[model samples]
Target: MKSPSIAKQLKRDRAFVLMFAPVLLYFILFKYVPMFGIVISFMDYNLFKGITGSEWVGFKYYAQFFENRDAFVIIKNTVLLGAYKLLFGFPAPIVLALLLNELRHAIFKRFVQTVSYLPHFLSNVVVASMLIMLLSPSTGWVNRIIEGLGFPAISFLQESEWFRSIYVLSEIWQQVGWGSILYLAAITTIDPQLYEAARMDGAGRWKQTLHVTLPGIAATVVIMFILQIGHALEIGFEKVFLLSNAATYDTSDVIATYVYRVGILQGGFSYATAIDLFMGVIGFLLVYATNQLSRRLGETSLW
Candidate 1:
C-alpha cells in the first residue's frame, strides 16, 4: 500500500498541528530570532550605526573582560554559588519525593505537598521580601528568638559569610516540592511486581525502596543530574539581584547581574555581550561533556 500524501497527513493531524503552532511560533520569534544578535559580541556595536556599519573588533571585548580587576572575584562568586546550588539543591527534591512516597496517609501527604509547593509559586520579589523581613536583626522574629535565647542578633543578609547558605537554603525550600513532582511521576512508573517480589523475599519497606525503587528510577536520576550540571552556571538572576547588596556582592555577584550592569546600566553592550557569549559557550560545553559522560557510564542519555 502507498503512503498518504503530505497534504492528507497534515489534514489528518490538523488538530495536533494547530495545538503546536503557537509553541513553534514562540520559539521562532523569541529564541531563534534573538540568536542573530550574538554578532554584536564581535562588533563594537554602535547604537547609531547599528550592525551593518559597526566596527568589527573581534575578541577585543572578550580580552577586556578578562583584564578587568574584578573579573576573578565575579567569576569565583558565580562558580561557588553554582556549586553550592548543585551540591545542596539537586538532591533535595529526590529526598523529599522518597519521604513522601513512604507516607501511607493520603490526606496528610497531600497537605504537606501543598504547603511545600506553595513557595515555588511565589514571585521572587515576594520571596526576597519575606527573607528580608524574617531575617532582619531588629524587630524580626528570628532575631527575637535569638535575643530571647541570650545570643546577640546577627545580620543574616548583611553578612557575606551567610549569603551562600541563605541562597541555597531558600532555593531548596522554594523548589523541593515542585521538583519532586518529576521523581514522584517516575516512581509511579516502577513495576509493582518488583516490590511484591522483594516483599516475598522478606524485604522490609526500606530494603524494597533501596533495592527496587532506587534502581528503577536510576535512569531518571541520571538524566536529571546531567541537566542540572548543564545549568550549573545559569543561576536565576532575579532572586539573586533582589537579595544581594554591596556587602554581599563578594558572594552573590554573578555573570547575569554583571551583564545587566555593563550592558543595560553602563552601555557597554559589546563588552557585556562578549561576556555573555563566553558563558553561553561554557554552558554548552558543560552540557555536551556531561551528556557524553552519562552515556558512557549508563544506558540513559539526553541524546
Candidate 2:
C-alpha cells in the first residue's frame, strides 16, 4: 500500500504537528546550526577575522592544553568532583522515592516532597549564597553550633579539604527531591497486582521493595543511570564559579569553570574550545559505551 501524502498526514494530525514545529525549529536553530562552530576549535579563531578568515591550526591548541602544567591537575579535579557528585547524587533519589512511597500519610508525604523540591527552583547564585552563609566560620549557624559543642570554628568554604564535600552535599540538597520525581513516576507504573502477590507470598515491605518494586522499576533505573554516567563530566558552571575562590580552587575547579575562566574571562577562546571539544568527545564516548553495555546486560538503552 502507498503511504499517505505529507499534506494528508498533516491534515489528520495538524494540531500535534503544529505543537512539534517549535521544537523542530529549536533544534535546527540553536542545536544543529551551532554545531558548525566546533570547527573553530581546530582554528585559531579570532572574533574580528571570523571562522572563514581564521588560520587552521590543526591540533596545536589541543597539544598546548595537554602540555600545560595545570592540565592534569584541572582534569583530575574535574573528574574527582564529577565522580563524587555521581556517587552520592545518583542513588539518593531512588532511596528517597522508596521512602516517599512507603509514607502512608498523604499530607505529610506531600509536605515533605514540596519542601524538598523547593530547593531545585532556587537559582545557582541563591543556592551558593545560602551555602556560603551557612558555612561561614564566624557568624554562620553551622559554626555557631560547632563552637557551642566545643569545637573550633573551622572555615568550611575557605578550606580546600572541605570544598568537594560541601559541593557534593549542596548539590544533593538542591537536586535530590527533584530527581525523586522521576523515580516516583516510574514506581507508579509498577503493577499493583505484583505488590498484592508479594504480600500474599509473605513478603514484608523491605522484601517487596527488593524483589518486586526494584525489579519493576529496573529499566527506568538503568536508563537513568546510563544517562547520568554519560553526562558525568558536564558539571554545572554557575555553582562552581560562585562557590570557588583561589583558596578552594584545589578541589573546586572543574572543566566548566576552567573554560569560563580561560575562555570568557581571559579570552583564550581557541584553547578553551579545544578543552571543551575534548570533554565533549569523552562525554559522547561514555554515553555510547554505557548505552551499548546497558543493551547487552539489561536490554535497556537510550538508543
Candidate 3:
C-alpha cells in the first residue's frame, strides 16, 4: 500500500542507492559485523579460548570497568579533553569560513585556504614529531626564539598543563582548514540578493554577515553540530597517542589510549570491550538528544 509519491520517490532514488551500494557493503562488512563481537564484553574473553569457547560472565567486565581505579581518571580526562575541543575546535572552522567570505581578493583567499588545508594531509606521526622538535626546551626553534625574546625556554610537551594546550592547538591546526571547506560551501549557497538588499539598506559588512550569511548557513551548522555531538566521546586517538608521554598521562590518557593499553597490550579483551560499549552507548544517546533538540529549535535535523 505504497502511496504514488512514495513509489515515485523510490524510483527516483535508484541512482542514489546504486551510488551508496559500496558504502552499504563496507558498513555491513566492517561496522555491523563488529557488533556481533560485542558479546565478548559480557564474557570472560580468553586469547587461548576462541570467542565461541569463552565463558559468559554477564556484567562482570562492566563491573570491573566501573570499579577500576584508573577508570574514572581515564573517563574524566577523555570527557574533559573532548569537551574542550568541542568548545573551541567546533566553531573555529565556522569563524574561518566567515572571515574568508569577507575577503575581496581571490588570490590571497586561495593562498590562505591552500596553506591552511595542507596540514590536514600530514600524518599524525609527522605532526607529533614536528611538535616535539618545535617545543623541545633546548634545541627546538620555538624555544630558541622564545629564549631570544628574553623568556626562559619552556618544556611544552612534558608539562601536564601544556599537554592539553598543545593537543588542542595541533588539532586546530590540522583540521580547521579542512573543516572550513564545508562551511565555505554552505556560505557560497547563500543568496547574493540578500547581501545586495542589506547593502541598499545601508548595512555594513559585519551587519550583512551577521544577518544574511550566518542565518543562511544556520541549517548546515546545526546538522554538523549534531553529528559532532555523536563523536563527542570518540576523540582522535592517533594524535594523542603520538604526542603523549608518561609525564602527560594524567591529561592525555583518553579512552582510546586506555583501550590500546588494556586490550592490545595487556590482552584484557573483555574489559576493553566493556569500556568501548559504554562509550558508544553514551555517545549515541548524546547525539540522539542533540538531534531532537536541533529539530525542536529550528529547521535543521538529521532525521
What is the lDDT of every predicted structure here? Answer: 0.92, 0.91, 0.90
How does residue 247 of candidate 1 score in lDDT?
Answer: 90
Query: Which residues of candidate 1, in runs, are more than 4 Å off?
Result: 1-29, 291-303
Tens digits of lDDT, candidate 1, 1-303: 999999999999999999999999999999997888999999999999999999999999999999997788888988999999999999999999999999999999999999989999999999999999999998789999999999999999999999999999999989999999999999999999999999999999999999999998888888898878887998899999999998988888888998998899999999999999898999899988988888888766788
Per-residue CA lDDT of candidate 3, range 162-267, in tens?
9888888888999999999999999999889999999999999989998999999988888888778767888888989988889989888999998988999999
TM-score of candidate 3 to 2 decimals: 0.86
Of the candidates numbered 2 and 3, which has the greater TM-score value?
A: 2
For model 2, residues 1-303, the per-residue Cα lDDT tens digits are 998999898899999989999999999999997787888889999999999999999999999999997789889998998899999999999999999999999999999999999999999999999989988998899999999999999899899999999889999999999999999999999999999999999999999999998998888888888878888888888999999999988788888888889999998898999999898889889888988888887666776
- Compared to the true structure, candidate 2 yields what TM-score? 0.87
The C-alpha RMSD of each candidate to the native structure, in angstroms, is 3.2, 3.1, 4.0
Worst 10 residues of 3 by lDDT: 2-11
- Model 3 lDDT, residue 271, Cα: 92
**What would you estimate as the lDDT of candidate 1?**
0.92
